[model samples]
Target: MNETNDMAVARAARLDTATLSDALDRLGIVGQCHKIKGRDPEFRMAGRAFTLLCGPASTPPGTVGDFIDDVPPGAVIVIDNGGREDATIWGDILTEIAHRRGIAGTVIDGINRDVHLCRTLGYPVFSKDHWMRTGKDRVQVERTECVVNIGGARVAPGDLMRGDPDGVVVIPRAHEEAVLAAAEEIHAAEEHIREACRGGMRLDEARRQFKYHQLQTRQ
Candidate 1:
């Protein structure tokens, strides 16, 4: 992608996960979460193409560095730990390398370590929880190219991932542009409705005036 285009996508993604979730809901997608909470926010990641699906306990010792090295810049790494909250697949070292390599933020379905370090480094990470035990013993990467399950969704490589404080949502490659456009429209319409609501219009009135019911119409 062109640098300018990438920057544009990044800007568009600056909206928080809630807004993105609203967009996804307008486009008919629900049930997305961070998988981790209360950790300091690291919101540096913003992109729209190429997702990384990492399986649990994967990333044996030296391999994580290589994985970070190989992932192209501007790609999101979605780590799937099979919902294992006992071990952490991402930590300080991985976050540092990912930041240096310009890889987009990581989304792990399990746990993470080095929470403070990741915050200090300003790397974005979303996971189920945090634990002190390292993943070396319990976690092992079965495969990098396989479909990894994340919060009930099957995240594959090359899918578009947008995340922020609220949660993360995966966008399949085939529907990227369409989903984005739909999201934009939904955001604009919702903004208008909010303004109307603040201007003394009732919720139902605002909905009717702004065609809010259209959001429920399936595409």
Candidate 2:
């Protein structure tokens, strides 16, 4: 990652999903990945998105993860399987390769399998859920390095993706600086409020002093 990208990732890692969501809301941006969640609440990831769109298999079916070989290090694999839950598009083999290659993480609008490997390897996998069923012969890759729908959010190649215990959010490449600025501001304000409360200031007074209620309101 370049210095700018590294800085963005670091800034995002310090802010939770809620703060980022509020930042997006303040900017009138739609970024929350609805219904998509982190498999392990303790795990967090931030990186540019490497998107893949999937659909029902063709007559002979198609590959699910051949694209892994091309994914750059530090890029989060964002897979859009049309929210299908019957099968999984990610598993142990992919997890191992991704980990070894220094890939940031994986997020799916559908599901994943062999979650044990993910947890054991300390790799982060965010998705709708997980199942043991395989996606092979059931799901096929439609396109790669393209815009893909994740939950209700549109994720494009190189878009910033951040996830934590709360969930995932995608920041458009064009809006990274603005979004990060907003989120950092919100985080600072929240920290001030917290410190005030800890120092014996009444919650209501502290919140009122900082205009807390308006922090997340559309601006």
Provide C-alpha RMSD values for all models, in order: 3.3, 0.9
Score every model by TM-score. Answer: 0.81, 0.98
Question: Residue-wise lDDT of candidate 2 within 1-219, one digit each (tens)?
Answer: 689988888888888899999999999888999999988878799999999999999999989989999999999999999999999999999999999999999999999999888998889999999999999999999999999999999999989999999999999988889999998888888899999999999999999998899999998
Clashes of each: 8, 0
lDDT of 1 at 175: 56
Off by over 4 Å in 2: none
Q: What's the residue-level lDDT of 154 in candidate 2?
A: 92
> Candidate 2: minimum summed lDDT over ten consecutive residues — where?
6-15
lDDT of 1 by residue, 1-219 (tens): 666556556645755555555556666664355454425654545564344444444334333334667678877777777788776787888888888988778877778889887788777877777878987756666567556777776666766677666667776555556666776777778889999989899999998988888764666
lDDT of 2 at 1: 67
lDDT of each: 0.67, 0.93
Name the lDDT of candidate 2.
0.93
| CA deviation > 4 Å runs, candidate 1 | 2-8, 11-14, 22-38, 41-44, 48-65, 213-217
